[model samples]
Target: MLKKMLKYLSSLRFTIVLICLLGVMFIVGLWVPQQRLLKTVYLEWQKNTPNLVAFLDTFGLTNVYASPVTITIWALFFLNLALVLWQRWPVVKSRITVTDAKIVDPVTASGYPFRACYPILPELSGDAVFAALTKKGFTLRGTTEGFYGIKNRLAPLAFMLFHLSFFLVLLGGLVTVYTEFIGFIDLAQGESFQGELGRYNTLPIPKMPAVGSIPKVSFVVQSIEPKVTRNTVTGIDVKLTDASGSTHLVGINTPYNTDNSSFVFKHLGVAPLFVLIDPSGKEVQGAYFKLDVVKGRQDTFRLGDFLFTANFFPDYEFKDGAHTSKSMEFANPVFLITVELNGKAIAEAPIARNGSMAFNGFHLEMRDMPFWVRFYVDKQRGLSILYAGFALATIGVIWRLLFYRREIVGSVREVDGVRCLVVAGRSEYYKSLAEDEFVRLFETAVIGK
Candidate 1:
């Protein structure tokens, strides 16, 4: 019973079922926000939706692939492939290397390509029939008991290669799911970060060994180039320095590739520098604040015992009794600033370009605003394996399409005191076409001539 189970597990139907299950799992994973998201973003999501946080925590939905369900599915699929390959290896390998062909069974030979009881000339011997077959350039691999003719014999390897590539691709994906690291890097135009152990942060909320074998990389944000329309940051210029001291310019979609890491662009938004001073004219707080995470370019922050709120309007408008930005560009920039203390509104007014507000013994001013971009740094250990899978799959598919494997077998046999040559043909695929070609070749090369 166990043997029968093993056989079934290695069958094509079993593999198909496992793959279908994996596909469904992959779709579900996509629908659920993955743990692969930025740590701050994911945490913010959980914080904002407490009920969803409980649900995701209960079933590990946030970390779908790393969860038990997905991992088990992948493991089973891998096992199915390994077993199927183990069972099929001998057949394909032998077909590729076999020099002498043996007679096939009646069941196999009786299919589409066959001719039975073809008469031998009454005076001609069986040896003469084979000599005729040889004259037709059959490339005989037969002893007179049976005759074997083959063309493109090695093409069967395409089947093996395609299956092997599937294994490689899946293995690469599994490795990446388990060990790959994706991180977000934030910087001002002139800011930079080192790629060392102490200088970076990654998503999936960095585990016990924080650094964890990540490749050393460092980069400085140079400048961000704006898009023509609306004048937003479309691309960025960066200077990257690897551990080897090599400096390279990087930009959006143009990542610097190292042995195991890739640095890609992720987030882009605006940062407005603001400074606040007490009534005594002494500076209190100053820094560049990001507005990307805050929807509608508005956010509330607490400083000292005061609550400060900023409402940004890139192109100020009060049309149709609605306060909205006409465009994303800073055409006529305006900020509506409001101050409150202990839930009581102290001051509220719209501040224009080069704006300032003085209220409740504090002075606030907008200094400058600029665009900044974030980079998604990735490090994968099995990228080579993934590339190999793609190459092999392509080669296998092309070979199968262009150079299919086929063979014809014939034998001189006497039945019921009548002697004749019995012929049969088979192909790796495209059976009907192979059969038709076999008949035409045999008739033209031997019988007709």
Candidate 2:
């Protein structure tokens, strides 16, 4: 049973199946809204599709990367690759091995897969043939009776490197799974984030490590400037102030990285600060509502049974009883707000910046419309290892494709009473190309050919 299992584990078909399984998991991960990465989106999805969400949750598909099934698959993949390398190591080593001082006896033309016999001058010795092989880029290892020559001796190691690269990639993935943490945080312009556990929009994944690894640093999003290209908002350039008061300009492509964590731009939206005053004149609630709204779209939130729906107009304009934005620029901004109580529309009005609207003896004030940017923070330590594996894989591909492992044995022997040089060569790959090279080597070394 052990032998059979090892054979299965080391088989090429088993490796391909594992790769296909990983590919399927990757596709599933892309299709499903991962709860760890987008908690709010996942929650909304769960609310709308409770049955589907339940099925996904039961199978751990919602958090596929952190799922036990995913971890098990990775573990099995690592085991299989290791077994394959182990099973092939001895054979691969034997093929690539060469002793420089070992002598090889001369053989006839029929001895090798590709061979040629050339008549030489009587004065021309075996040394001449050996010298010709050396000048033709073959390393001469011995010249006792004949000569043993090899070229691209290290090319066979490329096969081992290919497998080792895969092993490193799997190891890197395992490292990331155990040590990495990801979370999302939103900070409106001028607001500060102290890098606390409670500041994240959703709790970070792998909560235990996140608690320890999160950088104890604070920074404020000072301002945001959109990078416009051809009148389209391509990205944003953010001015940030760190705890030390040093400022940095960051954007979607360039993240603020520190303490093994990176703050990458996820998205941007409008945040309207609101102050709700009760009829008794007490400040009941005051907070910023980070509404995921864009041009012509509305977003809403609720306070104690009263729902507030708001649509923002940057560069606000009103003509012919229609409210719209003249452009994407924030030259002028306004919010058309509606209030509903118990499913009945109580009030509706368009409020300018810092304007107030009233309904049912309650006052709601729009303090400001500040752009908020969401940052995806992650502490992923395995990235360097993964990059190294990729580098190794690239090198292996180049070496294996560009260099061919070949061996040539030449001997100065007597055939039918005529002194001749018997040249034989073999290549593990690119047989035709290697045969052409063999002809070139003999032509270059032979004085009479």
Using TM-score as the measure, the top candidate is: 2
Q: Candidate 1 lDDT, tens digit per residue, 1-449?
A: 99999888778898788888778777767776665654576778878997987798678778876778777877877788889778778887887674653555322565435453465666777666666656655556766567677667677778778878988898787676566766666666666667654445444343322334665666666566444246454555666554456777777778877647777766666667778889999889887866562236567766667787888777789889766777765576677778898999999877674677888878887787765666676877776788899999999988866787666677767767776666777766676676667666655443434
Clashes of each: 1, 0
**Cα deviation in Å at residue 159, candidate 2?**
2.4
Model 2 lDDT tens row, 339-413 = 999888899988876898888889888887788898888776787888789999999988987886778877777
Taken over the whole model, the C-alpha lDDT of each candidate is 0.69, 0.79
User: Which residue pairs clash within candidate 1?
Assistant: 195-217
- Score every model by TM-score: 0.73, 0.79
How does residue 23 of candidate 2 score in lDDT?
Answer: 88
Model 2: per-residue Cα lDDT at residue 113: 75
TM-score of 1: 0.73
Query: Residue 435 in model 2: shift from native, Å?
Result: 2.7
lDDT of 1: 0.69
